[model samples]
Target: MTERQLPGYRRIANEVRAAIAAGEFAEGDRLPSVSALAERFAVTTGVVVRALEVLKAEGLVIARHGSGVFVRRFAAIRRSSPARLSRARWGTGQMIQDADTEVRPRVVDVVVAESPAPAWVAEPLGLTSGSDVLSRSRRFLVEDRPVQLAVSYYPADLVRGTRIALTDTGPGGAYARLAEQGHAPAHFTEYVRGRFPSPVEAGGLELQAGTFVLEITRHAFTAAGLCVEVNRMILDATAYILDYTFDA
Candidate 1:
């Protein structure tokens, strides 16, 4: 609370996060104009636009539209669930994973609907809220930024006409076509958590506000115990770095 007794937009976001860790703001550089930080912090360009919206919610700055605010390039992404949950990485419709990154996912939209679960998805889909299922909904991007946001539900008679009810879940995805329609996924159980997002997952991963997302939820089941899929994902907490190597 010592930053000028804090709160002038978190004291100009702690002096721009200590001038971006002392490299004096460098990544994509550029920051400084919000009328030159409201005339060098005498404050009020709406407190330098809420201190650059708290340094663009801590991913450390970026506001490019008419091209201005900059300093950001921390780019994360380690995500390894045994090499992107192999079955050879979705065998060819590439449900998005770009391995070691040249940054390429780009999937923005997908639909396939059914609905009626949503109370934190009805107890991980053992259903009951109103019970329907089959949702799907995606949204990812990279060079264009976004990040992730997956949804998934499946139980409408367990993925009805398969392709997990279309919108292209083809080729080894939807757990390799639910092991070719026999309910594969002997196990998968992620449940991680984090907060600050969900204005529809921070407008579908374009996140901000003290940044936070990485939700996950997963839950695939079925060695006959059935729970088909439940997914939920969200990601974009400064991109990501979650690795799971196995063999404990």
Candidate 2:
């Protein structure tokens, strides 16, 4: 159906989405009261409520316990994957996330350990099942809201005495440290999918019910064709716009 011919709730939702796109209702801006919107749209309060539910499901707005609905503050972070992974970024001591949205996420809750690789992790790293790997895990937060979880696994023997195994990988992160060990990443491959968050993932990212996650597994390979690292990233799907730019 044409937009104007849509049902009352859908029309309201479209108008609100358009207003948000036009920047009329900015991030964290409280939307008009349901009664006000109902009056303005000549619709019932129930219709307004349904409209708001539509926006909430799309992650465009959030409803608080005591306060009214507001535009989601952490919505739609544009993640330019190619740019974020470029050598120029990490090579210059800049974080990969710097290439994301203007808002930079704080890296928090870092944990480094050596553990036997899970079957899924070991195969990608070209290691035998049960091989030890250096695992570095951390959370990415923007404005104190957790948005991402990342874990990098490297062959333990290869990075045992290296900075890659430390909490702080220093300048350029693990890739830079790998360069010193003659395993610089010359290429990367990423596999991405969307799925419901596991209970642990939902808790870690503070995601609302019905929110999905983008699971990305990235493999860094040296020029010699050796896979040096396997990094798994989990991002709140609603919080990111995954941009992949390449030649046609």
Question: By TM-score, who's the top model here?
Answer: 2
Q: What are the runs in model 2 whose C-alpha is more than 4 Å off? A: 1-30, 36-54, 64-67, 71-75
Q: Per-residue lDDT for 1-248 in model 2, tens only?
A: 89878998999999889999999999989999999989988999999999999889778998998899999886578988889888888888887888888878889999999999999899988999899999999999989888899999999999999988778889888888888898989899989999999999999999877779999999999999999999999998887889887786
Candidate 2 lands at a TM-score of 0.81
The lDDT for every candidate, in the order shown, is: 0.77, 0.90
- Model 1: worst 10 consecutive residues (lDDT sum): 91-100
Span of ten consecutive residues with least summed lDDT in model 2:
72-81
lDDT of 1 by residue, 114-155 (tens): 877877677765778878888888888777778888888877
TM-score of each: 0.34, 0.81
Candidate 2 residue 87 Cα shift, in angstroms, is 1.8
